[model samples]
Target chain A: MNTPEPFLGATSHTPVRHHILSVLVENKAGVLARVAGLFARRGFNIYSLAVAPAETKARFSRITIVVDAESAPLEQIVEQLDKLVNVVAISDIAPKDALERELLLATIKTDVDNRTSLLDVVGNYGAAIVDVDAGSVTLMLAGTPAACDELERELESYTTLELHRTGRVALPRLGKAAVAADPD
Target chain B: MGGLFLYLTKRIIVQLTGAQALIKSLEMEGVEVIFGLPGGAILPVYDPLIDSSVRHVLVRHEQGAGHMAEGYALATGRPGVAMVTSGPGATNIVTPIGNAHMDSTPLVVITGQVSSAAIGTDAFQECDITGITMGITKHNFLVKSAHEIPRAVAAAFHIATTGRPGPVLVDVPKDIAQSMMEWWYPASIEELDLPGYHPVVDLDADRVAQAIELIRVAERPVLYVGGGTLKSHASAQLLAFAERTGMPVVTTLMARGAFPDSHAQHLGMPGMHGMYAAVTAIQKCDLLISLGARFDDRVTGKIPAFAPHAKVIHVDIDKAEFNKVRRADVAIRSNVAAVLEAWDANQASPQNLEVWWKEINAWRETYPLVYDEPAVEGLLRPQHVIESIAKAAAPGTIVTSGVGQHQMWASQFWKFEEPGTWINSGGAGTMGFGVPAAIGAKAGRPDRVVWCIDGDGCFQMTAQELVTARSEGIPIKVAILNNAYLGMVRQWQEMFYDERYSEVYLSPDLPDYVKWAESMGCVGLRATNIEEMHAAIATANTINDVPVVIDFRTDSSEKVFPMVAAGASNDDIMVHPLQREQS
Candidate 1:
């Protein structure tokens, strides 16, 4: 029997990095399920996903999906998503060529002794203390996904009572900056 | 709102309830027939259907209705329509929906839902059909209001018929079906506000040129045709392309009739249970020009080892299919007909395939499809029955089959010379597909004769549909190869599992097929030997007013030879023991 060789197609290789796919879809009932169900059925890994109404009219919802490229091919992901009837457009935003942001809200356990130090750490990351109670303080940060990750790491020193994060959202960078960064 | 105001001012507003609007929409789409059953949730829609131009054939089960719709679509190029009530009715049709999705058949399935207030409350006959069928359908619509009926129907038909055609579903709530609204139908698909749906129709020049360049330089080439060619109605173009290139063309199971079986350049079906020459030619070819054929696991065996020496040029209407399995050296995302038309215009001299044809011819001559006589003195072979039926049927007879050993025998023995003449559950391989599909095909093409080659196990699954045929005045012929066991499973158990047989046996005489046919108002006959089989077939051909069923008692021990075991390389294909011994 002849041993089979590994296929060397575009779908065969596993990417080492994450892919952020911004999809615009019709604002209809079960549209989100259709998009998410496609991913689950096709076995595509979703790291994070956030959806919100795009523009003022709310005719369409923009879905920001961060996919683990190691599980599914990028080309296949786009092609499959494009097949959905509600999906209007899909843009794969590269890390450098796009502006990415995420929002983090954390309630940290703090006392008099560590309150100043926690405030200093929060200040260093440019995070704001939205509310301050006797035992805990609530902080909010809206920044780059990497920045949010760093701030979350710094807050790990203190006890985190509760933490919440809005998944990353992205758009292609405009003007000459995006043009210069084009790998093509 | 502005468009509604303009329509109201420009034309007289005709007030109609949602059910009436739905039926009127089907009429506007020129739907000639619908296969369905009425229930509590769908009764309102049925009331309107009585007065509409669309003829409704009441099916015994929702599964039969779905398969009949699929058969109608497969026989005719038009999208088949099927309607059913909520819950079990919707769930029963999921198998055929998945089958249509896999085979890329154009089907528009409508399922009734509980009233708007009853949805999500687990009311009687309530189920989230749209959610259940999301993965299987090309797209689906859930009409919340009466006003959305016309647009939803229009969109469902458009999505089902265009691009890589597959099943699309519309789930209408019972309350929505009863609510009154002004009737307004969209003039065209463009007016339906579907910006996301666009099927690629034009061929990319660069890819075509690259494929042509490969064809020019390749010493050995094969034209691998698939169901997409038939879907695109490109059989003529494919025939011309094959003749011009002088390449050996191998049609897959779904594509049996896309190219004439009698054509000299044709190499028969390919893959597991495929012809020895056709499978060997693909394995040894240097250039593989795949048209509308996906590299399904059944055809590829072990994917990495399949056509290892070939540089594949894959063409399909669906872009996602390009690199889904085998990578294409040149990928053309367009209709198969468009690509063939483009390639036909850029005419080049045919390549010299003398050495290739000589090798393939030798294989064909050495391992021609052969079966030995049954060990029992008077037992009939299933293959012989299929051959006899094929010989007796008229030139343009349509053949449908249930999945199993019988389906393979029918595909192997029948000589198909035109497109849309062969319909079967190719992708999903759903059993009990033959009877309902044959009925649907006969209903679609009343002028042509339709024959269903079914297995006993498969016949029992949806045999109730024969009643639908009799009551609806559609005449079809069914030849049940009654081996008394699930022959394919028995073969696998014998070959790989130490012949335990397990529960594969279904007693030959339990139901009495002749009595069952008579119960369903069909003429039933029985055959045990070749002479009896011939006589049965001859009697079946003569009955034009009523459907006929013939029970052929065949030897259960026979297996489909020229086999490639599951997950094995194509190089390890096993010929029949008799043929091997002769060679």
Candidate 2:
């Protein structure tokens, strides 16, 4: 397992790439505000965020924050967050980790006959056809935003359908020890 | 002998004017003790403190002194004074100063500057302290002359304590501190026309009524109270509004105890670190009334989904915050108290959203705030310790908490009778906040019992302040939830990651807490069981001259339940020890 870097830095070693921050919090009011306040106050450019209570308790919830900043500030983001009153802990799950970040995109297609072809394209990206009707077909995709975007690009070949996507949601491989801070 | 006396008189004259003026000004504003550490440049200021009646607590570190002053100011509802020397000494206090700015604690920080001639030169121990602290301070000054010291000190107190209370800095040059001048205390503060400061809490009542009307029509209504509620001292109004309307209240981290925790209408804190109950309630509610709060993103995760079903009514003194995130459906730009009073008198029906309340409450009961029944049965349960503290606390007593398991437990177990009774560094989540905040809270209401509930990890971070508490004679009762490690991080390592103790586990040879407290001239209580805790609390309650510490050896494995796993929806709640898989 790769040890996570300390969540504080002046610059990222790597080039620009979309980063996702998944946070677990007490399921309470103003918790979102508290979290968002952290990001905004610290000037963390959060592209998107999705929150819901975990399966554990009503007082606990999970939040996935999407960003595209240098890796340098990510550490500061995490370290500063450890001080949040409602945050239990923060972990920057690396992309290589056994994790699944999922999203569902529903779109209305005008081309009925070409729907099978669109379904086939989505299938390649691990999405499945969830609904079928006269004018539109809704496809459910579970993967990274890149995967969903690729499917959406493929679907565009057939009548560029109406589309809706749930923000990114992820789950790490459970029962694994969290990677400690890298001493290097 | 006559020649020696003449030289001594001249030396003392220069020192008496600058330092004496600052001391006189602070005392006039009712400041008794200033928390700080000394350096060469600040020695002259320290000189008058020796002869002056005002007491001074010489803190071990300058940063701790700043935090202590912040805590004292927060507790007493008066401006807290913190003194430090040049460069690192002044820089060390920056964090607490910034904290005061964010949380709006009234504080006056006096830092010793290099001699006036070395102001901008790369002199020894020199720094642009004022420029560095500009963003965090309400106002700042560099006392170039001895006469400016009195005016600057007076101005700092006024700015720090009025309106939106925050930290103000007065950098006194070394030469100025040694100069002589007539000490002048302003007869009244009414003459200062502060450019940005608004002394009165004037709010448009008509606009507030419009906000109430919007709430009356909202099907699923939610109330969000922010730090402004605490700043405005509008706890009564906030509580009354939530109770009368049967609306679930969500408090920002800075506004933790703005609403009573025990209120059935309380939905808990919302945002990223917020409870699931609050997020769900906010997401599903039709109308959200934000009082004394800015719609910070933490509360409105993915703004589109934040209170997706609701139209937001925002009430705040800062107009810039209006629609800054989730746009307000009805905006009342006013002081919290004034707006609430106006809303209370308005013509509107209390919109009944019983069905909505039922749905949210159902979600709450299924995922109640409970941990696995004490993994180790013999250990003193953290909950029991918290409950006993609550039981023993006098009515309207104030409780402050540090960031960790202890804070969560306090939120779950402590039954708050009124708003503003509970204080914590919610938004900033500053560790070691409890002791200082408790000191502040105790100073705020002298008659009330102030309980500083802390985790051992957090307590130890700023334990040096026990000296400040002792020296000041502020009788704050500290309940240390000693889990023997960074309990919260350890829990994460246990559940999400494999159990790798790493650096999270604390050492066995811990500092002698009892001896430490005693050394500071404060009482200490160590409770390995429930009985001992009760006895300790009772004994501590009887002592008024000093503070107390109660060490509770809690179960290390216990967890805060009802968790939302990372990156999950508000509906996907992990109810402790069990999963409430369905919404």
* C-alpha lDDT of residue A124 in model 1: 74
Across B1-583, the per-residue lDDT of candidate 2 in tens digits comes to 9999888776333334687777777777788778889997787888778877776877777777877777666656567888999998999888788877777788899999999988889788899887777656766777778876766777788777665577888999999988888655565664442322444445666666777677777778778888888888898987776666677787766677678777778877776556767877877878778887766654565555556677778887655456556667787666788777776666344557789878988867765555445433466778788887788777887888888878877876776656557777655567887887677566556788888889888888888777777776777888888878898888778877888877898742387677777787888778776677778878877877788887777878777665555545545545555454443
In model 1, state the lDDT of residue B358. Answer: 93
Q: In candidate 1, what are the lDDT values of residues A53-111, reduced to their tens digit?
A: 98744689999998887887787888889889898878777766767778889999998
TM-score of chain A of 1: 0.85
Best by TM-score: 1
| lDDT per model vs. reference | 0.89, 0.72
Clashing pairs in 1: none
lDDT of 2 by residue, A17-103 (tens): 655667777675456766776676567777668898877776678887766555335555664454343566555655445354547
Candidate 1 segments whose C-alpha is farther than 4 A from its true place: A1-15, A176-184, B1-10, B374-376
All candidates: DockQ? 0.41, 0.01
How far is A43's C-alpha from truth in model 1 (Å)? 0.5
The CAPRI classification for model 1 reads as: acceptable
